[model samples]
Target: MTETLRKKYRWDRIGLVLGGLAIFSFGLAAWVAPEEEQVGSVLEHPNNAELPESIPALRVQEIQTEKAKEPELDEVVLPCSCNRNVLKLAKNPYSDHRRAARNLPNSFFVKDSNELNAGKRNGKLVEVKDGRGFHISALSHSHAVLLPEVKALLEDLGNDFADLLVGTPSEGTRIRVTSLTRTVKQQNRLGRRNYNAIDEASTHSYGASFDIAFTDRPDNAADCSAPTRAIQQVLSQYQKSKRILVIPELSCMHVTLRP
Candidate 1:
């Protein structure tokens, strides 16, 4: 009977331990249930091991995107002093261009596109391209061709222009040639579109002239003051020497090679 009673006591202790473990497990489940439900909440995002991205990193990116914006209205852009003192620059008359375009030693009328192409084939009109101090812009209404002598003159002008600006802030600045040789058809089209177009045949139609619209400095390393002055000095020297005829138009500086 004593042995039987001892066996009963051991079983009772085992049952008590099992019951306590069941209660502990139930309490743990109750504590985790609320946390699991709140895992997807916007305001209470809990750390999740299964997430593909770092939770902290994603939050930082979102904050940055929300704060991103365009430039402010009052943001100041420094102005370049290109116009000051450069007003003394020559503004040549257009009538001289008309006279020189027809009478210049190398000038000849390019009546149409066919004549323009023929001039090119016969080596009368040479191909014009970028050189030392000048660059040809995308020509929309003109051919990239000029009289051989005219081309040479242009090259000399470019080289001299570059030399004049050497060691200055506008050292690498280049004059932008906006227009080149234009046929009669192209001239008419331009006349219809542009109010500044010449009333009669343009000097460009004769492959004797080009237009300089802007001087651009690479990298904005310097302001326009140096480039502007350099242009004035170079063009004025050429004009005074009677080597070229010029018309300082509203859009560009029209230049014609003079014999």
Candidate 2:
């Protein structure tokens, strides 16, 4: 009876150990296995994966948040009031302006940016900035520069313009110089769009001309009449004196420094 009881106890112990081993192996398999939905979700966001893109992105924004640049005051063309009814000044043709422009001291056709830079370095051209009487507009197709004589003429004109309106409501009015020296390339480009570029070549390429588009008032203290009359008087005096040639264009007054 004792021998049979020992045999049964040994068999029972072996069976219990085998059952525990099977349960542990099944639990480990369940823990290691992943669902199909989990793998698809991970693939959707490749950027969040272990590696970056092999090919770089083109036209990708350098800055995530950047403001658009705003245009300058001179970049925008203002409406002009100078015409037959207003100002009523003498009108010079592009022919006359070009003729005078071509005859200036050491005058030569400025064909490109290289010539322009050489002119500036050798004193053929002088830099022009916003001064007392006139403020240079933000030039897109032109440069803020002129011949020494032309710059002097511009300064004188500004002084006279301010003097004329002394004690008047338009005392602080300023002439808006819209255009100045331009390269031949710039002229050719403008000619396609600007009817005023009627001449085969523009005087602006010689740094001998400028355009006045508006008489900017300091305040609304007075109407444009006073300022308009002042422009008429000054421009007329200069034109009659043969000091400067003028072209009364639809949008602006083109003034050339006479040779």
Candidate 3:
């Protein structure tokens, strides 16, 4: 009976020690555990790893779509002044009106029709033939002739002049060549009608000068004035480019090749 009582006493002591240890372990776990609010929020809202990947792809597609909708602009190439100046080097010098109109050498004068024919045959002169861009005045056609270089210059000018007048109200307008080559005799006859004619030492005799009336129909005010300013603008471009020297005369614009 005494031995049994001692064993029971020892078991009671062991049980007390085990209960104390269990209480200490519960306190430590409670101190280290995360807050319920934080743990519950994390569980409710999972991280979306795929969201970042989709965002960049959507942004790239939006940028590409905007680029495709934008208008394509045409590339405009500007003309180089150096290249144009090089072309102007082919122009003549004495053609400028600033030079003294003194006794020009006999070689410079078209003394008669025979000399004019010689010039034409030798390719020194090009007869001004009426065609698409221009029409020679009836009085001038018979004697219309110019230096080959001058003729080419006029042809190019005429083409550009026509292009400028195109799409305007007076689109089909043609430039008029009122005077071209003039001999001493033709000059004498023209002098009777035109007070501005330079009877002696005229550049016309040299086959390097011509006159352009602003319009073919001088009598029609609607036709003459509409394109006059525009035509002058085109001529001014040529003058500035050094291709020709222009004299804005009362009746017409006198143009001469640069010597």
Query: Could you give the candidate ranking by lDDT, starting with the highest?
Result: 2, 1, 3
Task: List the global CA lDDT of all models.
Answer: 0.76, 0.80, 0.63
> TM-scores of the models, in the given order?
0.66, 0.67, 0.54
Residue by residue across 72-168, what tens digits does model 1's lDDT show? 3223323222221332446556666777778866567898978887888888888999999988888899888988877887888888889988988
Model 1 regions more than 4 Å off: 1-92, 193-196
**Tens-digit lDDT track of model 2 for 1-259:** 8889889987887788788778877876665455445666777767566335433332233322222223343344333365545667777877888899999875667779999999999999889987765788888999998998999889988889899988998887888898898897788788877776657678998888998888877766777888788888888999999999988877788899898
Candidate 2 segments exceeding 4 Å error:
1-80, 83-85
Q: Give the Cα-based TM-score of candidate 1 against the true structure.
A: 0.66
**RMSD values, in order shown:** 8.8, 8.8, 22.0
Per candidate, the number of residue pairs that clash is 0, 1, 5
lDDT of 1 at 171: 84
lDDT of 1 at 98: 71
In model 3, what is the error at residue 122, expressed in angstroms? 0.8
Ranked candidates, highest TM-score first? 2, 1, 3
